[model samples]
Target: MRGVVMYKPGDVRVEERDDPRIIEPTDAIIRLSATCICGSDLWPYRGAEPVDHQVMGHEYVGVVTEVGSRVHTIKVGDFVVGSFFASDNTCEICRAGYQAYCVHRVLMGALGTQSELARIPLADGTLVATPGHPAPDLIPSLLAASDVLGTGWFAAVAAEAGPGKTVAVVGDGAVGLLGVLAARHLGAERIIAFSRHADRQALARYFGATDIVEERGPAGVDRIKDLTGGLGAHSVIEAVGTQEAMMQAIHATRPGGHVGYVGVSHDVALPGNELFMSGVHLHGGPAPVRRFLPELINLIWNRTIDPGKVFDLALPFDRAAEGYDAMDKRAATKVLLTL
Candidate 1:
């Protein structure tokens, strides 16, 4: 089997690797139909996160080719979508809707889904079978359900976005754009997306953004407040895990509002005094995507939402390096790799 490995920052290659096989009684192996590069992958690619010949991707959607004895619900030949974090889905934390923090959770990135064949641990808990084998056209959307869409949906839900609520998104990446779509699906009355890129701004509008704020830091917060009649938004989604983006999201929410932050935090610190005075609720981490997988898969299968549109570039599996370069250069919003 061939898989993507980052030998070091700025060096990604498709190399032959041993094929995955069942390692646990609850494991399942799938032949990937499609997989894609994630914004988080860039962290290692850019040297922000250390990489030592690390396996590259986490988002995937594919057909099961093998299943362990304990994997009853998901069987060979089933089409499935799974989260970046594999969980038992039966733990106390999982029962409370926080599968991402399950006692037996495993980070799928370590297993690396950016390959022709990959093993899924805790298969019954992590993988959700689609209604049927998805058509070729729906594959991209199904693949999106694995991570970006799930994370965005979790962000919107955490922020409590719904009818009569004003939602603001602090980033313009695929997760943030899908956060816009999630806000709309949840019935947010007004959606504000902060983006300097015209293409992303257009996509934000298409996903239900009522306004676009190009400014960053304090200026972006001011724009959000100005549009909200000086009260700020009822809810804000922080998709970029930076001090600036986090502060922008926090300052852009009205007092007593909510801020859902899902970006992978990096050297971010919040001011205790300011947070105490703000009187806002903060929630979010690695999204409990397994909690929303069934619903999300249905929505994608029924074509109720089109999160797949976020993938602006597609490349063959062997050209995985090119896909990473495109994403790092910002030439593509999201890159889909075909197997």
Candidate 2:
């Protein structure tokens, strides 16, 4: 089988690799129908995170080809979507709706779904079969549900975005843009998206952003404050993992508001005194995507929301390197790799 591997920063290649097979009784094997590059993959590609012949990609949607003896709910021939993390889904933490932190969780990135075939551990707990084989047009959105869409939905829920709430999102990446959509679907009265790119700004508005703030750092916070009459937003979603973005999100929310941060933190530190005085609730880490997969799949299947619009560029599977380059250079918002 062929899979994507990053030999080093700026060096991605499509190479032949051993095909995956069931190694656990609870595992299931799937032949990928479609997969895509994620914003987080850029961390290793840019050297911000170490890489040495590392397998890439996590978001995927595909048809099951094999299932272990313990995999009863998901069977061969089923079309499924799964989270980046494979969890037992029956653990205490999972029962509490935090499957991302399940006691028996497996990080799927290590298994690498960028390949033509993948072994999904804890199959019954990790994979969600669609209502039926999805339409070709719905495949991209179903694939999005495997990760980005679910993560964004989790972010919106954590921020308690709903009717009468003023929501502000502090990033314009796919997840943040989808956060706008989630906020809208959840009934946020106003949604503000922070972005400098005109294309992203337009997409953000299309996703339900009522306003766009191009500024960053203190200026960005001031702009958010100005829009909210100096009180700041009722909820803020931090989708960029940076010291500046984190602080901007924290300070951009009003007292007693909520800040849901889903960005993978990279060298971020919060000021104790300032955070204590802010009197805001902070919640977010790796999103419990499994908790929202069923609802997300139904929405995507019904065509109620189109998160697949994030993939502005699509390339053949062997051209995976080009997809990485396009994303790293910001030439594409998201890249979908066709099988």
Clashes of each: 0, 0
Model 2's TM-score against the true structure: 0.99
Candidate 1, 212: how far from true, in Å?
Answer: 0.6
Model 2, span 311-334: residue lDDT tens: 899999999999999999999999
Q: Quantify all predictions' global Cα lDDT against the true fold.
A: 0.94, 0.95
lDDT of 1 by residue, 98-137 (tens): 9999999999999999999999999999999998998899
Model 2 root-mean-square deviation: 0.6
Poorly placed runs, candidate 1 (over 4 Å): none
lDDT of the structure predicted as candidate 2: 0.95
